[model samples]
Target: MKRLFAFLFAALMLAPAVQAAEAPDVLIRRLSTEMIDRIRADEQLQSGNLARMSELVDSVLMPHVNFQRMTALAVGRNWRGASPEQQKQLMTEFRALLLRTYAGALASAKDQSVRMKPMRADPADKEVIVRSEVVQPRGGEPIQLDYRLEKAGDGWKVFDVNVLGVWLVQTYRSQFAQEVSANGIDGLIRSLVEKNRSAGAAGTR
Candidate 1:
């Protein structure tokens, strides 16, 4: 699951933001390519500077992603049980968790490049799947990647990702359920915060 999330998000995490008006496939292509190029050229990011990467994720990638939807999906049916305040907290912590994990992935991804497959979706459809491949430039086989997006107002927002046949939201749902079952939402939030803090410390070093 850790490796899956890393592969699933590495392309979108540290990229330069694209226009909201771009089609989903176009958006993925542009961002994926730009992220690879930019991350390689970026001294601080390539050196694993968490602060710089976090700033980019918060300012740039967050808007392009429907994180509220992501949090709801990850939390599953229990999402409706949370108070509005709890929901807000969950989103905050989840965002931090993803940013930290993504920063780590970006730092480690040195010889990888993203390639977009031909997109196949009707223009009238409100939901679409954008498919792509991640090339491991050093050798071996490419990875299968797909972004599941839904129309949100004028732009499409990514809510879940499928990598090598496993959906990221589904992968986390079981973990979240276990935590919620044992300790509840606040417990889950606390867990995320602590993990992110530890990851942050590692990133700084």
Candidate 2:
């Protein structure tokens, strides 16, 4: 489960930074290639060194992801019910979880490459699916990577990634909804916060 979360986080962090002047497909391929290169080159990430992996994720990945949007989707209808403070806490904890999980997955990056599929998307639509293939070593089946993209301002931002056809946000949504149902939104937020805190302490130790 942790490894699966890490793979999703790493993929999310590498979402294409679309340029105004470039086609979305071209930009996605370029950014994805660059991210793969960075992962390959980083000694700490390649070696599964946690401290450097954490730093790499914080510096290179976090800025590109829309955590607030992800949190809202994950929290489902409970997002509207939360107070501002609670909303802020939820976003913070969720962000930390992704970052930590991404660091953990850096070890699995070896010999893995992403192949961007041809985009058959309507330019007029604000939202579209961008598909790719993750080729792993050992000659097994390729993992399908589908990114859910939304036009935000002048560029397209990815809100979710589907690995091997399983949507990450949707998976989290189910878990989050269950948590909220069992203990309310506040309880869910508290649980995430405590989990983040515990992970942080464990890393320090």
Candidate 3:
């Protein structure tokens, strides 16, 4: 559960957006506006009182993400070596990890706003870095957010995020590699399942 939540927060730090001629601020504002409206309209989510934030996150945020591609990249060379069954298991676990993560992080979405920085680059570039700040109501300080985006067919998709300068995909790659090395793929799967089960039990209470 902790791992999943970590991943979702990392993702939120770098939300995806189209790579049109539109300015970064315009894209960010559009996404933020849509999200706020969805939050208010969903009865199940609104009544869940933050507990149900996961539902909203899963429905709205998950659609824009490319988790399958992200997982393949994270697995790196190991993905090529994995058998069909192993590949399937890895995808399942990865998806669950993100789902549980989205649920938890959305629950904590208090009064927050995003400030997008100016975009500076040619449209032909294969990648663009979208910078923003997540301002919280508590007034501690704004969190630095950076989205590493890649040009997909007719659009730009987020492949990685850095929060307060910490790159999420890199962090998971290191940790996941260590776990696989220490316990093997089966061991890693077991660990994810156990953690997910525990989180489910807790959510019920």
Best by TM-score: 1
- By lDDT, the best candidate is 1
Clashes of 1: 0
Give a tens-digit lDDT track for model 2, residues 1-205: 4554555456545544446555556656766676567667777665556666556556656444566787899888999999999999888888777777667566676567778888988879887888887777888678787777777776666677777778878888999999999999888988898888888788777
Clashes of each: 0, 0, 1
**Better model by lDDT, 1 or 3?**
1
Which parts of model 3 are misplaced by more than 4 Å? Answer: 1-26, 40-43, 46-63
| Candidate 3 per-residue C-alpha lDDT over 1-205 given as tens digits, one digit per residue, 9 for 90 to 100 | 3422343343333234444564433555566555545444555533333344454445545444556667777776677777889878887887666566555555334345666777776867887778777666678587777777676664555676677788767777787787788987777678778877887787678
lDDT, candidate 1, 64-174, per-residue tens: 788899999999998999999999998988888876665666555656777888989998888899998878766868888899999877578899898888888898899
Off by over 4 Å in 1: 1-10, 13-17
Per-residue error (Å), model 3, residue 205? 2.1
State TM-scores per candidate.
Answer: 0.89, 0.86, 0.77
Q: In model 2, what lDDT does residue 119 have?
A: 91
